[model samples]
Target: MKDRAIERDMDWLVQVFNWAVRFRDDSGRYLLSENPLRGFDIPAELNPRRPIVPRDWMEKVIEAAGPTPLRAMLVIADETGRRLSAIRQLQGSDIQLGRTDAWPHGAIRWRYHSDKVNKDWLVPMSTKLRTEVDRHLAANPVLGDAPLFPAPQNHRKSVSKDRAGAWLLTAIKRAGVQKLDGTLWHAIRRLWITEHKEMPLRERMYVAGYLNRQTMEMVYEHIDPLLLQETVETRREYREAR
Candidate 1:
């Protein structure tokens, strides 16, 4: 079996053993003491790499997308840091365009089933993204229940994930940019998270729909190499002051 599969099976076995121990005559005392996956090292390549998309390259891709609805979709993904699947699944009713007293710039309430957390959630959209979405909606009006980014060939159906990805790839190629190894959409998400590193942990987690700081750190945070020196200098200054 593959290393990852082996690791998963080992983890499952450990959980099962621990549960079985709870019902034993000795109770929790006889539980497995060591992790079954302790020694096995999965290849680094097996893990997901959270790469931040370069802002310049992203701008070029967006420009290459022209005035299509796909461009709006890209902008939303970048501005709001929402998952591509969640963004693609957005319907007209999922967006709120009215001018709220609290937010005069307008706002969007994105309600979608998040594949990552395996749950449905409503997240507040960025004001800029909401404005871009408003423009897209005004230009290409659809029914309340219809998809915001409907398939070009079928108005009733939402754009397929593959088609949306292909659109992005075509734009990337047109802009003379090389595609990153991992999903392009994820790179945009990473870029958003990286840009907001200074935001409070709670607020960042809330915006990204992450349940915990551990998940945010493990899956979302990707510090730019360009900022490494600055980060190190800040840390050094703080330590010296203390």
Candidate 2:
């Protein structure tokens, strides 16, 4: 496995050990004496910067995707900026259409268990997103707890992560977009974040299901200096000096 892949495995194992150490039986005795790997030093991961997908490239790919489940996944990724894991496992129950107190238009409830952050996010759906989702759900027609995108072989389970990635690659090829390094499903997410950089930091973080501000600003956002310069030019001080 690659270094980052191995690091992720070690992290998951450590979490397992921590859970086991905390588990108790009916007798109130600890299930495990201690986390064996509790004090183990995990090397810092050297992750490469992920490039943001251009809007035109993404649109081309989405258009080329046809009516497959991948098309919906791409739209969700572009609109919500949430992880692919959450998108793949989306259920009919997760969607609440029509006006709500929280969301006047509608909302998509991202369940805690399905995400890495372990936080439930009620994200308001954009008009474009709602239209696409409505079209998909109308055709697909899933009831409560039924996965929006079920596995072809087994309808009981959602499509595997590998399968989803493969579908995306296929779409990219059909669109004739040069698949650059680090431009994966997550790249579209970065694009979403970059496009919404004008929003208040905390509010953006909440919408994006981010727990840490640093992670959102440092990892997910790709700052465009030209865009920043244009925004700065609009400031009172710059205008007054002209």
Candidate 3:
């Protein structure tokens, strides 16, 4: 993999690593946990900052995705901030968890069986995306063990990394993000938590399936876009005396 894609892959791995940490019982998960990847042992050139797709860019990307299941999936991801692992595994049973066509709470649930969070994950489901998803599920009512996204039809029809990347590339184009590097599914997850900074650190960790804040802050420090943008903008208007 090239340097650009390497960062993308690392972002993906970070989410997986985080999940693995959460899945494991207390005792230090692995040797890597204690051994810091920092310091002179690390090469200077590897200290590159990974790029992310701006939220505004995500809007365009969703528009550009054209007509495909991947498009709606990306839209749900951008709005809900779910890991692709959970997003791809969405099913009628999952969506129906504590929701209804009438209530419209704009949140969804992820079952442990199909989640990398490998437990239960509850996330806000945007109104717009839910309409689209519900429509799709309505068409395919044969809710078998398979997920809504692309999975092999054979015995172990799990989602493959290659297919995940392809679906994401299409979303990247639709999102209209210009980057020195590309983004990954996990980046979408980080974007959600980073975008919601004021919501109590622990709550963010629970929402993202992180065992704690130290690890959440470790990877999310560089993502500077805060959840306060709306508040700051509104206050600015008030201060302006218009």
Candidate 4:
């Protein structure tokens, strides 16, 4: 069985077993122990794959999206390195356009509430991204509590993840980029994380809303060969100077 399928089964088993334990004649004697199947390893080939969308491809996708809200979403995802779900849940109130004492380039106070972690985190947006967001907000004024990317059918609600993914797919098609099967939206996030090797690990983790270095390195970080080479050269130069 697939890792996810196994996980689902294990979860269901736990629930059923716990329910039985709670209602049994000898409940104290029927306690469910730790799940033996909790850490089943997924085969590398079966893992959900995310293609690395290069900076040029990202530009093309944005260009294809034009001045639409989708374009803003794409830019924000790339700049913030946030998960698609978190990006979709963004509210107008979360955005702070003008420069702040803490964030000279301006920042977005993103609230991510999920099973992994639930907290409000701030991340600085690039000048270009901030300008784009400002233009978008100016063109389409919304209430502070309204969704940043409001649903077309309902302005009060945020756009569904499926709808956002469809918009990204359309942009990818229009841009003539290779279709990356299951990697369209998420690959952008991966690209964003991968490109920030210059940033300190702790700072990167905080900015990316990651709980630890292990998860960041194992799942998110995709070291670029060119970047690695550049770093190696810099080290060599420093050593020669000494």
Per-model clash counts, in order, read 0, 0, 5, 0
The digit string of per-residue lDDT tens for model 2 on 1-242 reads 56666777899999888888898889988888898887888765687557889999999999999988899889888888989999999998998887877777688999998888999888898888888888898878889999989988987799999999899899999999989776497788899899999898887887778998888888889988889799888865545554
RMSD per model, one decimal: 6.3, 4.1, 7.9, 4.6
| Model 3, span 1-242: residue lDDT tens | 45646556666666665565456456655524532222313223355554455677666766777666667677777666566766776764566534667446555667786555468866656568677776666654526555566464542354565776786686665565663354476666567766777678766766566665675676653446343475566653346555
What TM-score does candidate 1 reach?
A: 0.75
User: Which wins on TM-score, candidate 1 or candidate 4?
Assistant: 4
Highest-scoring model, lDDT: 2
- Computed on alpha carbons, the lDDT of every model, listed in order, comes to 0.75, 0.87, 0.61, 0.78
TM-score of each: 0.75, 0.81, 0.62, 0.79
What is the TM-score (0 to 1) of candidate 3? 0.62
Q: What residue pairs clash in candidate 4, if any at all?
A: none
Clashing pairs in 3: 60-174, 61-174, 61-175, 106-125, 107-125
What digit string (tens of lDDT, one per residue) describes model 1 on residues 1-242? 55656666767776786565555354435455555545655444366446678889888998899888889988987887778877888788877666666656555555645356655555556766776777788899977888888898998888999999999988888889878877788888888888888888887876666666886776777866778988777753345554
Q: Of models 3 and 4, which has the larger TM-score?
A: 4
Better of 1 and 2 by lDDT: 2
